[model samples]
Each structure stands twice: as structure tokens, then as C-alpha cells.
Target: MILTTKSQFQSLIFTGTNGEYIAHYSHWSLRSVFQPIFGHNNILVGLEALVRIEDVHGESIRPDLFFSSTDISIKDKVNIDKLSRVIHIRNFAISEYKNLKLFLNILPSVSEYFALSDINTCLLSNRLKELQIDRSQIVMEIVELNANNEYLFVEAIKRLSQAGYCIAIDDFGACASTIERVKSIQPDIIKLDRGLLLEHFSGESNRLLEGIKMARALGAQIIVEGIETKEHLQAMETLDLDMFQGFYLATPQPILSCISNAV
Candidate 1:
């Protein structure tokens, strides 16, 4: 990716649209939407990058539908994943909240593929260098890490950690986001899935406290997502959690739009 001139860089399928950089693939346009990650002090500490997909008619498409659709092949899924990051990186570089941490997701298949390859995180590293973003400011979140090859997955996490990028295990308490995997990864942060919060509120389990304790004792920050109510925010604060995110704090919106208005 050695670039001698701006022309070469501009040829990456990103179109300049009304002060924003968007990636185009097939008949759909990919976008980066940010959900605020708030700290204990109720300050903006980071943003979780979420994807938005739209068809040629500009009609909104569910990300889950676009991402999990069997209508698309595995190769295109990986390409869309990469392009999602590209659009996010380019957009974040031009946003006002560039100083805060930008949490980018690593697709499960891509993570597994990268782990076995020599270019593990070179693409991300090169992109950040090209954009002049500090490696520490990027959070490499591995989704569905439980599905990846265990040995190579840990190796990939180690490689990224050694490269100065903070690692996070997304969706704790769901699927196979178990303690064994947590111990194996030992990520810098562990994001609790929203279901855990629901169970806690319903008094069905005390796993929430256990999760917080687990993350704390492991020397990792705990972030609880899906805090939609005032009680939700208060309860998290009472636990002295490290970070929080959900509709109560702010909804997911495009980074370019967030700068003009308070999120």
C-alpha cells in the first residue's frame, strides 16, 4: 500500500459525499455509525463502530441481515467487513472525536483467516499509519471469537496486543463468550452483552456482578452495552463499572452527524 500520490489513494472505491467518505460495493453503500461509550465519570471515552448498509434506492437495510445473509458468499462477506473498516477509518479521521478511542470490529471469519496468515494485522496497522492515527487509540474488537481456531486466535490477539492496539472481547455472556475463552484471550476490555443486564434486572441471576468482578480481577475494563433506561445507567454507576453504552447515553448515528450536534 505504498502511496506516492493522492490519486492512487483516491481510487479505493470511497466516494466523497457531502463532506463524508463512503465505501461502495455491489449495489449497496457501507457506512460507519458510532455509539457512544461512556466512562464512569459520564464522559465520552470511546465509540463502538457499527455498520449501516443501504441499497441503491438509499433504503436502510438491517446490518444483521446484510452481514448474516446467506444470499451473499463468504468472500463478499469478508470484503464487506474490510470495506466497513475502511469507511470507518476514513470517516473517523475527519471527525471531531478522533481523539477518543475508535472501537473497530474484526469479523470472526476474517480474524481466523488473519490468524493463520502472515499478514495478521498488517492491513489495520498500515491503514492507521496512513491516517496518522495512534495505534493505542484503536480498539480491535473480536466478535464471535469463540468460533475461531483457539490456538491461532490467541496468537492473533497476542500479535495485536504486542502491536500496541487495545483488544476487547465483544458480547460476553452470549453464545460461547465464556470464562475459559476470557482467560485464553485476557483482553484489555470485555463487553457484556445486553442479555446479562436483562437477567440481572429480572433478578434471575447475579452473573452481572460476577462478570464485573471477573473483568476487574483480570485487570480489564468492563463495558456494559444496551443501557436503555435511567435505572440502567444508575445501576451500572452503582457497580462502579468502567464504561457504559446504549440508548440512554446516545443512539448510534453517523460520525459526521454527531460532530455538529451533541450526542
Candidate 2:
């Protein structure tokens, strides 16, 4: 999916429903985004969120670029109510289907800026109450917790968990940062990198498998990313992955619209 831009860096715009605009990428709309997953009962389920953007063909855009950017201006443009938008989306998703858990990501560093104030301390908690969704149903995917700020990262993890959100360490086995992240945050879920999944059963595969086991032993769920082919899906089966995501199962789709009928 392509980004729509008013600024030269159109990528930085995040348009929410009701014409709410935020210059920051954090909490970008996902009303057009869908999370395809095998439900607890092993059935294919889709948990849709608000704030998703559509591409030229009306397909949902992948959010990786939006969330993981290094540009400081992009980060600053995000609203302090970013987490509140997430909580609102989670509630909306649950209203449609009670079976699937709501998967949402958090910029731990960004969230700390808004959540630390005494007045807005219960922002997330109040949203949870209004949504009537269980904290266990919320999976907060955390990205980019590397060696530089171990103390702050740890504090972020502790705070989120204390606020009752399940944590998942995303992009594991993709970077050199894996083991250190595990030692520091101890996430409740470990999302295997798609690159390692491509190296299935090769020398790298063994290392990935070991990492998965370690996370599992720590009471973390294992999710394999980037399953695009039958072979990839089969390889994931061998690992008994707790969850799956990739082009094969279902690519990201616009939340308010249906999956593309082009195929």
C-alpha cells in the first residue's frame, strides 16, 4: 500500500477517522488494517483496527515503516493520546468478535512521555474498563529495545505489565539484539523474524529454534512471521508456532473494507 501525503514526507501523516489528523506516525489509523491469525480454536480469525491507510489498489498498507522510523520529527508529530487511540481500536475489534485477542503495538519510549503524568496515569486503564476487554486479550508488541537504554526499556516493560498489558518482543532472531532483549524485558511473546523463517532448517534455523525454546521456557508464546508459501507454512508447522502472519495466510487488509478481491 502507498502512503498519502500532504507534506513532502507524506509518510509521516496519520489520518484517523472523523477527520482527526496527527502529524506523527505513532497511533496512525488502522480502521483499514486487519490482523489475520489462527484463533485459539485454530480457526482463521481477523481482528480489525481503525486508522489503517489504503494503497492504490485499496489494500491495507503495512505499518512497519510507520512505526519503526528513526526520524525525530516524525516521532514528535505523534499525539500524546496515541495509546488512547489504540485502546479505542481494541475495544472496537472486540465488539465484532469475542474470539480473537486484540494485537496492538506500543512505542514504549513514546508511551512513557504521556503515561507518566499523575493526571493521565489511568488513561489505558480507563479505556480498558470502557471497552470491557480483558488485559490478557491485549498483546502489546514492543519494537527496538536494544542495548543502549536497558534501564529505560526495563522500566517500560515493567510499567506496561503492571498496567495489565501482555508484552511481545517483536522482530526476534532478525537482529543481533535478541538475547539482550530477552534478558532485559522477558516478553510474554517472541515474534520470530521472517528472515530466519526463510532459513528454515539451515544452520540459522537451529539458532532460531533455540531462541524460541528459550522464550517458551520463560512462559512466552512463539509467533513466526512472514509465511508466504506452502513450504514456509509447513516449516512453521514443524516448529508448532503459537501464531502465524504473512502473505500466505492473509496480507494486511484495510480495516473497514474487505480483503482485496483482485486475486
Q: Model 2, 9-71: lDDT tens per residue?
A: 344435556333333434243343555666333466434233453444556544555444475
lDDT of 1 at 46: 87
lDDT of 2: 0.58
Best candidate (score: lDDT): 1
Q: Which pairs clash inside model 1? A: none
lDDT on C-alpha atoms for all candidate structures: 0.79, 0.58
Give the per-residue lDDT digits (tens) of candidate 1, residues 1-263: 22222343345556566677777777778878888898866788988888888899999998767667779877777777777877788888988888899999886666665565554346667778888999999998877534546777778777778778898988888766787878987899999989999998998657888888899999999999889999998987888888999988888888877633545
- Provide the lDDT at 16 for model 1: 61
Residue 102, model 1, lDDT:
96
Q: Give the count of colliding residue pairs in each prediction.
A: 0, 14
TM-score of 2: 0.71
